[model samples]
Target: MASVHPRVPESGIMSRPRPRHLAPVALLIVSALTLVGCGSDDESSEPPVASATEAEQETPGPDDEPTEPEDDTSLADFLRSAKVDDALVNRLGEVGDANGYGLGEGVETSLEERQQLATVQVGTCRDVAVGHRTWEGIQASDVSSGGTEEQAAAMADFLREEFCPHVAPYKEAPLPKQSLGGPEEDAKGGRGLASPVSWWDTRYRRVSWSEECAAQTGQPIGDPVAYRLSDDAVVCATVPPAEQLKKHLISVDVVFAEPVGEERAQDAALSLLPIDAVAEDETEGTNPDWSYLEGGCLNLNIQSQDLEDVVAGLKENAEPWAHAVHYSDGATADGAVGPYTGEVKQVSLSTGRNEPTDSGDLTC
Candidate 1:
């Protein structure tokens, strides 16, 4: 399932990758929820969606898994409640009642990462909130049912009524059918825009991002920053330090993807920041002891000395990158690794996240 809204195609964003295959988020794959319910109005449209994978695989078994809350009823009842105040204390205490199954890279605190956290039995309120909202709105419709234009019309309609008005404060405000972003690209790079600014992600404003260019440059951003969602797959940010440090460096970008999930993004970027903590911290005990991987940290720290060099190289240069190069062994073209035909949907170098759509129009 693609992550974009059923009506929109995924060719909104694109990223130019460097050689050596170091960038983590090579491909942005959003498994979109099936929004247009099946059958008819008689039956409840909501089918059981995959909350996440079963914990038996990635997580440690009974021997290594934690055993805190043996009783499952109390926990479920507590989470489903409108009032969790009294149970809050007990809830925090009972967090690890089950084993930490399938939490390999761990869960991400932001909405972007909730996609991976859904796999576990235990989760944070934020985790539950984000995942629930995303999957709950799954509207699955047959592509042929509403011709592409018809789908685009439906999408435009949805944005107009349910999604657009809230787009005012965004960098790219007015989302007309003619275009979703700014002006058209000119010979001398006149006016510009990529896609319509999205509000689906902003429904929950917990994410933190800057309004302008927040590169790692110590100087100032000379350009206006623009970002777009690949339907439901990206969250871009023009962050601060990135902007502050933009002078001496080339460029620094980050990407979060499946399997390893969102927490990895936080972990990856954390080491780059000046501070040791963030409002949304990494997963508890998420980093393993990979102390022996040459210069690689269990947390996957990029060389502190080389950060500026890498960023400088990225910003000052331009080269096409292919995400398929980073795939693990055994992944296939038709299977896990595929002949990736998705479109590059979003690019926010500030926060280093990119979302792609599978519309088959990508330059890659």
Candidate 2:
């Protein structure tokens, strides 16, 4: 997302992320025998787009496993066609794939060691909240959810259970937070787009945001099939419904040490997604899920966000992901508050040479 310039003009299609279930539609021409089976199936003529991370986490699906990958295209290919990196792609793909069985899901790459391990998991729900990254290391075996001070302290309880106490949990720092300033404040605790937005359109849809660190799962930074966490920390958000949003969640099980040496721990990821394996009508459309199903090695990264973003509902830049937005559709005007966060650390009003100060680097 940082690659695209702020002032760059957008075409008609790059506009919005709304009407999630929109697709090409046409009445089916079924055979005589096929007509009978139609009574049992309720088919939708619309095309399926990516689901949000919040919705997926609430509904359990295939995204919670590390060994299984949906039989669909890699998340990278999909986002690359849209505009993003492979690592981000893998992160988003898992979100789109989550259907049932997996809770939080997505791919992450990291090194493992004997006594310590660093792991990350990500996921996406239709509308629960934006995506996120998590960090887990030598603290895994005895790790705490960090839900609350008391919840974190509970790890010691398991350690003292005289019956069986081989492993336990411990408290760690809470995940970073983003300052709130958007529509999401009413429900979740993620950040929002900066004021005064700018807009655009892509692929015949209105896609707008000020800043986005989007992840598109299915492609690997080095591996694939990430995350297989259980469904404890997940909660459902409304924008997307229960069933449609359930198809995107990939959880990573990175039980390996971050400072991995000769004896590295094995990491795994598992997920259930909108496989769309059988395209009943070839003329109708191309089922997007076919590509990711053909799998590869899965990575479990211990990142700074949620357990599922395999489909990128909300991805951010740097480790401490901040809330940001992009504009689309005629929704934003030029010189808007959005796209405010730029990598441009330079001043432009200078003549022959630019002066530099503590403010930032200046360019003529």
Top model by TM-score, which number?
Answer: 1
lDDT (C-alpha, whole model) for all candidates: 0.23, 0.18
Candidate 2 ranges with C-alpha deviation above 4 Å:
1-71, 77-238, 241-364
* Global lDDT of model 1: 0.23
Question: By lDDT, who's the top model here?
Answer: 1
Worst 10 residues of 1 by lDDT: 290-299
Report lDDT (Cα) of residue 122, candidate 1.
21
In order of appearance, the predictions have TM-scores of: 0.20, 0.14
Compared with the true structure, model 1 gives a TM-score of: 0.20
Local accuracy of candidate 2 as per-residue lDDT tens digits, 80-196: 322434443333233222311112222222211100010111111101122221112111211222122332233223212320121111111222223322342112221111101
